[model samples]
Target: MESTMTGNASGKKKEIHVGLCGAGIGGVFAAIAIARAGAKVTVLEAADHLGEIGAGIQMTPNVARLLRKYGVDKVIGDNLVRFEELNLRRKDGTPVGYTQTSRIEGALDQPWWLVHRHHLHQGLVTVARQHGCNLMIGSRVVEIDYLESNEVTVRTEAGETHVFDLLIGSDGINSVVRRTLFPAVKPRPPTTNCAYRAIVPYEQIRHDPIASTLIQKLTMEVWMSEKAYIISYPISAGTDFNMVLSHHRPHPVSTVEDISMADLRAEYATFDPRIQRIVDMIPNAQRWPLLVTGPLPSWSSPRGNVVLMGDAAHSMTNHMAQGAATSMEDGAFLSVVLREVLAARIALPDAIRLYERERMPKAFRKQQVSFLNGAIWQLPEGEAQRARDRAMEPELRGEPLLRSPNLYGDPATVLEVYGYDAEAHAERALQEWYNGQDWRKDEGTGIEAPVAEKVMNWFLPEKEKFVSKI
Candidate 1:
């Protein structure tokens, strides 16, 4: 296969062709960013349609600023609900502490938005297409072959073969690209937590004396309790309310299954009466067990050309509400790094290395933070639980909440997570990597090394057995 380089109107740099394995949020966002950076991108989606499931996503300022830069925020303008605060409360409806979204926006220079997943997905699709991204639906990537020419050939289930300079695995947790890269690693097992999700029309609850209060104002509410937590907020311009209830269970069930309202109510029987009333208003709901994977030793393939992002790289629970936000950040970071590679300012291997080096640590950190947040939310009834409640009491009294620092820090640290700019981070990493380093030699060698040898050398210095397989 021969490499092809197309020039833009200004004829500044060669356009890099990027093959994306999934057309979900991350893939589509990456497509837009790459196209905006003057590259050609094609997204392969397995589904026949380009839409997201029934759910709501919280977009922090970090993600919002990137979306604005990509023009996605304009496409989704006013169709989203902006919240002033995130209200935390106990299961009994006692107010804990609150994070002022307004304050965060003032600090970050962008608003916090809650939007329907479908709305966000549709907006991204629109903006990506506007940037001339080729979105091929019903095309599932079945296999990927890294060629000796420093190119990649992707074979879809439809038997069509396409070659590109880079291949990205943005296909969520069950990513085919991820499986192909690490066949020894098994599918992630289901976590002990199961979630019930539903969307109720605002009109349905607007007239109810108790339920109407939930919709009278716009705020993201979280109710924490022993072994369970509930999150509810308005989405789709407050025409509907999206709610998710997660609880610990003894055994794992199917990821998604039809669940009865009675079952949901029984599970949250100990919750506040107001919460129960809201649960009763759910016309339909589905339960799914959360699934997670062990952090991969590396997100990139041994060859370094093929890599993972978003949930494909690090699947975490929703406790932090950063699932979609972090995926957007991944796309932003990858696009910036690839722009440097395509411009010939950096070698592909070094670029990929820098991308992984900057992203892996942060992604893993967020994953651990998300896990810890979930644990805090679901602490069982005990002395530990009482202490947590006591710590939250100050917040209830409108005082600055004092939290005992542990493995994970305070809410301020979470605010820092929201303040991160992925694009800036990637650019800085690139600068640092090129500061007196001779990356040109690796570039001259076509960036090819034995996959097994590289993995063994990097991960297990003493293990020479894996090198024999290469």
Candidate 2:
């Protein structure tokens, strides 16, 4: 109901408040970035506590650079395993594709890092608090009353309601904000591919002869077959090994964290014996389906006061290892474009539009690429599999490639995808889009649309329909 100007070091700009749902890495980092850009951001998290979480994640150079920029690299320094090598192989260690992590650093100027999900999340939360971002732990956003008049009220499970100029839904694949706002639409159809994830102590493998050789401190090895694969890397300062066994199933599964090792072994029966041995060392595993979100026609609400972020925007599979990276990019890009709102160069809606136009295409591209790579990985042992193997020939032989089936082995992709600078990319796109734009803003307070457009929007009975459609 109230809008005013706030004077800061940058200049006198519109005082804006954002209600952010979900405090995962993406949400928290977005808070930090937005607060640094001089906005007031409140993060509503469902979890009561974000403690020493488990599992490991591969951080590509692109995201690794961002983490470093925020000093997160220093915070999670001791917990990282700088990847020295990446191997794509059959269960028996036959090479499907391989690359030295040095190549990533040599071309992208940043190291490939493997870290515990908790460490990364912790690092983001630390920086976010430092940036004056407010955190509401245990406050699950159950109702997002986003209206056509640019009014958004977020109600949590605890019955407290808060209003903000904007709402960002980084609430993850099963986002409450998304469900509350766009109740009819679904993220994706159920997925068939699921995975069993477990962490075994490094000492367990160290005592076993075969399993010990299968793992190394600075290596990530992925073992695959026609239908199943296993990804293993060290995490938590190399004290444990993170193992993910991807398997295909005929029916959908309800995800459970503590699945019996018997079920895991039975499912992965056809996988490499080495993988089986590694599975034997695991006491428990979690069966998590590789869920994906259908790409929204637009990542913003029709009014633009409310929007989606991270997996809330574009959830995908694990093939590209870019889910976190791309989500973080979403935050960094938002920080840049939203600054235009704070500076009065663009209204909030236009800023979101610009952010969507510039960022969504790339995010969608990553989604498709991730799905494609998963398909390539699951090809049965036949001509298709051979074709995939041949696709790796150029990179394996130390030669140049023109769009290899193996996305990771492509040098051009390595450069373009890994070396991407989010702020630079958004700035360039916005500059071009802003220059050609026809609308004007009243010093960022509001957009000055023609009378007809305003009247039409005012008359529309179902504005949420437009937002959902868009």
Candidate 3:
């Protein structure tokens, strides 16, 4: 590993050495940002190789903003599928509501993206490597000795030990790092649902009449019913169609385990024929038990040098699809904090405290709303479900409102959730600490065309980027 990870290296003694456990979205995002901010970061990933298992994930405007600014968006390029529309339907395949995504994207000055989880992970890792961040694959943290030394000593499962000025646990929900940091705090109860994510290659079904026609829609079509919802969309640059089948379970499963195709078919036997056909084509899927965690007393060590990010700190359901984005936000916010501390603009303790204080409330909102979103989708088949369907009328006509039944159609909620900028928030936090001038007065006031929008407009004059309104 290089001695420095920045455009400018002093070629002298290092200022700070940061260690990160897990190279998932949050850890890698932090690695890139922190390295770019002028620090050395060593990533220890437990996996034998670097990759993502899940097939599909969505990135709202808030995450898109960070990626675009850091050039990760460009790196992913055409693999990114900009959602043009989202359709809500009943279990019988009856249309309930429809909303255009461009309106929200335009309002936020960022694009809504759907892509293979591997693509997103690869982009982040590429950028992190480019920034000179050292990646130690197959190194899983087994022990931490922060109590005895000024620096943290992390021994991996393989018995190799490494030292760092700061240790960040960006590992997922079952984080060993988080356990060491907060010994006795119990994890939140698991959600009463499990999600089976599967991808069907379009090439395999291009000859089938029903499947081929539906696969080319390029929109997220969600089918809702009592206690379950199925979300499907194109991923892997439209070569694969991704499906997320979430259903209510009386008791949560113990862990992510292999799911049988016949068992999955039985679970969704009551669904529409189209859904059944897709499930039949799925070669494999893992049943993932959704979990909610944290709002713990804190996410840092007593010494404030060892910290938790991503699922290590907070894990929520996928109802809102903000799980991964929130993880990335942790790293993005920390980048700003570390930048100030490295430049001597803020004290390390105060900066860390600012991160803990400011991020807690924001994270709380996400955790709660994620549960709320699940409730709305999992409404029982009754008058209440009908009433919810009626509330989606405005969005069905393409006019999203402040409080639409379709949460994504509600502009206010979209802005509140997707318009968040962690880096900007970190900036604001520092200004408040010093009672400095406001730098965000002009931000969020105007919409500038993103690079994709500009090129898309020029290349495909016939293809309108946004339809109707902003």
Candidate 4:
């Protein structure tokens, strides 16, 4: 597939093709969306073999709703475990605040789900295949060419040249597309915050009394101490449990050269006795420094055809668990805007800008909020701990954190974010591009697409197979 770069100054969609970089979750879904909108999409993944590695991912209702609309709900539904609450507590496991996941669920008009990342990626890959999205794995993008006509030509490490109407830089934080677009800015190094993620089988935990209790609750629990926080949740719900320990480290670099179960136990030695019991049950762990980036000046290329998505565009700490959700939202919105722009015969450059215009502000806001959440979650040691204790002491005794002026100074601030409907916004954006509709009306009216089941059941059998094997 090849095409000579040309300016669509006349605003026509007859010649737009998209080259999507990265075949991870973001790139896969983006391909599905663009293909569903009747556009030709080519996905280039770097890894020789493409697969997901993470244990558990929290998919908010907003994200679920988008998956439902984009014809990938079957896989998501089959792979997800619905989580109903967000429980916050002190290091000793004393309750500080508990909020019903329903508040977020009802707002997004879908269920909040915890799913294994591999299954989610497989589901997206399946959908893309069904939609005629050409996927080439092991094709690492080494360079990008953004022409004056707002077209992109990507060259792979194998010396293969792929040209398309638009190039999407979904390759991730260390994106080659991003580097080529903005060479001056080096990616920020990993910060002091480090995390150890481990998944333990539920059967092993059933033998241990304390571990069994933590697993039986079906609750995503967090034990917070001045030094660190331990969070674990049932992923396959009774089959396996995933654990994440977040802590502040001194300037000395902590490497995971010999990351054994013993090392994991030692790290959590200071955790509450109950948390320690669960940590002891864990047989394996992977440690990595959590790297985050502040907001960027622009997410689009200087000429406008190439753009970034997900971690590539805005990599932030996982304090809010909105990383995957935001990326899914990006995939959903980009597909719609690109399709509408083509259908209405809008200029390619303007279409790209419109996308950047709509997504950048929302993404930047989430990035900022996520950063703040991380800072608050991992406050400085001495006086900060005391101040947190004073603020939480009343709440622990029975007052709600929402009302204590501690957690959230005003709960209303949440309405701005938890309440966003990305699909509704995409539709309004489509209407504006196709029929001259108002953009402001789409802003926060809570108008969302009602959930629908996809016709294809491609993922049902795979889910059954994975579950049965497990």
Candidate 5:
């Protein structure tokens, strides 16, 4: 365990020690980024094994671009299925609209991909290990203490205490770190939305004539209707088909239970014949309650030494498929700020503040948009639904679906969400902080000075400044 202090005997800059709570996609990715930025990182995972339980995850270009930047793209790309287009259909498999992802690929300079969650998780674990990040599995973080010396002390359930310069709460929605920091903030109850997921072997589906053609083209398909929607894509290098069916419930289910194939079929009885056939092929499915968190007043602790990332900060609905992508973006941004802090270009507190400042707004917006997008997808039949279908009819005529007026208010079309550059945003923030443009001013006197200067001066020697008193 290396300390985050400088002034070593070798005359080299001391490594910034970072402790991350949770070793899911967000934590592992953050560890890799910070380790590559020349910081020493340790990830604490409560699970005995480092793996993902989900069937598949959609990787948009925004996330792919950062993975490429970290050189982990190849690892994920090797096992992923690249789709050329996204198809929106009705319950009966009638084409409503389509989006050529090729356009997105060309504009973002990266391809969109679908991958098995386990494969992606394993790939990230390998990359983080290669970058020298220490992974502590089965070590649940039960408590966190901010020491008076400006260090964060993490205590695990295994009775181990580790001190670090900063602590990142990348734990998922039920984060203990977040609860310890903000005890009064309770996550909103699960909405009426519930998702059922299952993976069927391509071989099983390929034997059927109707399903065989679906696997051949490598396309992401969505069946939208009133009160329910189904999204299916090929994963595991097209060997398996991942499916998720989100439906509205009149009342919330108390627990996630194994849903038998017969019950699943009964639920989708009104769906298209193709969907019924696919559901029949699945042996079993798991029901997952779609839980969302209300916006928190802040993502960082009062001291700014501890902060939340990923779902711990903003757990959005999976409507836009930005849940994992946004978390990876958080990792990318934090890496840049940590690198600057390690190089002495900025203070650690300022780096963390900048991270929160840059990420909080975008994260909250994604949360809101995810909810809204899901609502639009599950719109009931009426004049509004008819208008939406009419708007989508242009795409069937070879026109761009995004050009439809109906999609103007949709967050999926927002360039900031889809075309964000995490690295560039981080670099710009650091540059501004370095140029003294990000300084805070006294309300009454209007005296200006970098917030980093004020925080650093409390720990280090004071330096001469333009304005002596604020």
Candidate 6:
């Protein structure tokens, strides 16, 4: 294998030697982005087979644009469902929060899609290969050492050590690279929450006429309760419906090893009959314990040549369905920063610092939203949950006091999340940095930690009635 970019050097085109630690969605997209910027990319994966573990996953417009920007959007769009609307309802089936899917695409000029995790994974792998990335499966990076020269040497389980100018860890939340960098960062305990997921054939869905129609629609519908939240969407050309039922209770069997239909039914026994009926058809359901992590002390190694991405850097709750979307966004923004660094001839450490400085604040803001969503959805119904729901109803109905800038804001609401243009910011930041300016630290002018908190509280206010009711 060629070890350096000089082996196949052509005139004029700048070449970067990049090594990626995981071949998952984030890793593959990073490869695509770096390759588009004229880099020689190599990906290493621990899994012998290149299949994802989950059932279906959602990709919002933010992720959609990243894939489109990297030329992999068509692969995802060709095999996924484009949700036209997103409906949030109470357990009793009363509508709560509503938003047109058009707003997402309109804000970002890209569409949202839902696909099987395996399908999207395969699509990303295909795109990565087409873009000239060398994907080496079953070669897990067992250790990483940042040399004095600002290069990285990664040692794999197969007893191979590869040195590269830069190393990226996209190895999910259980990142080997992250653990090596910071052994003290323990995985957060199960948020007292777990989800049971399965995909049932669309034909079987028709058995329940009312739900079957809803299941076939081009919408992502979620029903919220203090006990749990139910999310269902159409995937596989409406031939199947993806379902995830989450709750805030411990299970008799926490491991995915022994999960069966009976175990699933017992966990979901208190849900609506409609949801229970759907779970009954699923002979086997996978159990996934939810986890949380705080902002890292540092997202990049002290060497600056090593950095984390995706779940390794920040793993948020799935309440907002932003985990995968945010990972893709990370890849997009990280790529732009790397390109800027290269153009400006910035040192590797400074570039990594710049990337983390620009990415962390936005990622943290989303993480806060995800945490609040989990709290609201998992609150047990009593006087507290009931009063909390009542407070949210007004906000859902367009109360002026509750209206502000958020991920779900309507027209006239500034697009902070979806409307962001990382490519543009990156280009400007690069030009400024090259001209000996410190634009990285000042990327988000007037956007501070307190400002983000205040903005978030506008949509989600503290419910004194909830505390008093309890």
lDDT of 5 by residue, 1-470 (tens): 12232323444564678999999998899899889899999999999988998799987777887777777777766677787777887777888777777867765567788899898888899999999999999899888888466889988889999998889999988888889888887665357888898899988987888767676778888888888998998899888889999887778754576766677778778777766788788887788877666588788776668888898878877888888888888988999988877776566777777888888888888887778777777888888677777888877777654455223222346355666778867876665565456544555665554443334322343444433431
TM-scores for all candidates?
A: 0.87, 0.87, 0.88, 0.83, 0.87, 0.83
Model 3 whole-model lDDT (C-alpha atoms)? 0.80
How does model 2 fare in lDDT?
0.77
Comparing 2 with 3 on lDDT, the higher-scoring candidate is 3
On lDDT, who's better, 2 or 5?
5
Ranking by lDDT: 3, 5, 2, 1, 6, 4
Error of 1 at 51 (Å): 0.7
lDDT of 3 by residue, 338-406 (tens): 887677666555666778988988888899888788778879999988998998876766664668778
Which structure among the candidates has the greatest lDDT? Answer: 3
Candidate 2 per-residue C-alpha lDDT over 22-97 given as tens digits, one digit per residue, 9 for 90 to 100 = 8988888889888888899999888898543448887888888888888888877889787677778766677777
User: Any residue pairs clashing in model 1, and if so which?
Assistant: none
Candidate 4 C-alpha lDDT tens digits along 306-348: 8888888877667677777787778888877777656655556
Q: Where does candidate 5 stray beyond 4 Å?
A: 1-14, 253-255, 405-414, 436-470
Give the 10-residue window scoring lowest on summed lDDT in candidate 6.
1-10
| Candidate lDDT (C-alpha), each | 0.76, 0.77, 0.80, 0.69, 0.78, 0.70
Off by over 4 Å in 2: 1-11, 51-54, 189-191, 254-258, 394-400, 437-470
Query: In candidate 4, which residue pairs clash?
Result: none
Error at 155, model 5, angstroms: 1.6
Model 3: residues with Cα > 4 Å off, grouped in runs: 1-14, 186-189, 436-470
* Candidate 6 residue lDDT tens string, 1-470: 11111211222334468898888888888888877776678998998977788788877666776767666667766677787776766665666666677755764567778888888888898898998999998898887888566778888999998988888988887888788788788556345677777888878878786556566567776777776888888887667778888766554333444466786777656665666677777867666766655588788777778888888888877777777777777777667766644554555566677677677887888788777766766667687666655655654665633342223544432256555555654564554555455432224453332234334423344562112110
Show model 6 residue runs off by greater than 4 Å: 1-14, 251-257, 387-414, 431-470
